[model samples]
Target: MARLNVKPTRMELSNLKDRLALSTRGHKLLKDKQDELMRQFIVMIRKNNLLRDEVEAELIAAMQEFVVAKSLINESFIEELFVGTETNVELNIVEKNIMSVLVPEMNFTTSEAEVSSDVQYGYLNSSSELDEAIDRIETVLPKLLELSEIEKTCQLMADEIEKTRRRVNALEYRMIPQLQETIRYIQMKLEENERSAIVRMMKVKDMGD
Candidate 1:
């Protein structure tokens, strides 16, 4: 049902034949690329699911610890003791390429707010339990970020796969077949014309004889 705009001529037919060949080759290549990308996307999707679950579990545990820490020690004392010990933290992020796809890498760093607490005002001070909670939160943060990035990358890859699939279908099922049919039609017409011309020439020669 699809219509091509240009009028078909000898030159145009030759060009169509060449284009049909190129499209067939391109279709195969794109099909392979799409398959590879889909495989990678599926693997990343599985990893993302696992990481998401782990992050959720760790976040819950950290929250519970925070509650326990708050109950065990006075808020004012904990605040005073930890405030001055805070240090600045910087995270180093790197990008990784898989099958020519660039994915994000996450790094965790300890910040001043994480290390320093306000516990100087009273006898009660921050304990290892609080540090444990902070550590768990820090550990989960990067994983959560990684999961997010992976999920997004998978989505983008899926979209590309769909687009490639459509192009392949068009070439393999529609455009190439139509071009071949047109070529056959032209060849048959030319053959018929040649046969008719030969028969007429023979009749004229016999009459002259």
Candidate 2:
């Protein structure tokens, strides 16, 4: 590695040594952070995969049920029922810190929501299949929301890991090496200057004698 462009002096060497020490310490801390972030990121990825699989299966089943329900009911009536349906669920978004990374937390509030069936059409016109389909959809809604949050967290953590890794590499490969080389050059220059000064003093002493 190339030495940094710095003055060949004791003071410059001292400053470079100080910077190297701080850089080494920072590199160690960032390595630790990268390691921990990787661990958590892997765990989050696994959870995201499982949750996505489960959510996909649930969605498929719910959609199948909905299709069957649609086949039994008139399309216009189904559309009207959907249009008239009222939902009172509220979602709150908050952030939490993990390893210096901010991740999302979603909280749902449905205190005012009715627990009864959401199949708002008249019983005489709506089949039991429609009610069952609506119930299945409702059951999977929370899991779907949870899957979204987990996936986003996984993405955020992965990004942080990448960023940390880049920083660690830069310090280890570039900045630290340059500082060491520059310090060595300065020390060599100082030693050479000392030897030259001693030789000149001896010559002057011999001339006076």
CA-lDDT, candidates in order: 0.74, 0.87
lDDT winner among the candidates? 2
Name the TM-score of candidate 2: 0.90
Mind giving the per-residue lDDT tens digits that candidate 2 earns over 14-39? 99999999999999999999999999
Q: State candidate 1's TM-score.
A: 0.72
* Number of clashes recorded per candidate: 15, 0
How far in Å is the alpha carbon of 70 misplaced in model 1? 3.9
lDDT at 195, model 1: 97
TM-score of each: 0.72, 0.90
lDDT of 1 by residue, 1-209 (tens): 44355554667668878887898889889889888988888887888788888888999999889789878888765566556555566667677766566666666576656555332333346666776777787677667767777787777777777887898898888887877777766666667778999999999999999
Spell out the clash pairs found in candidate 2.
Answer: none
Model 1 misses residue 135 by how many Å? 2.3
Error of 2 at 74 (Å): 2.3
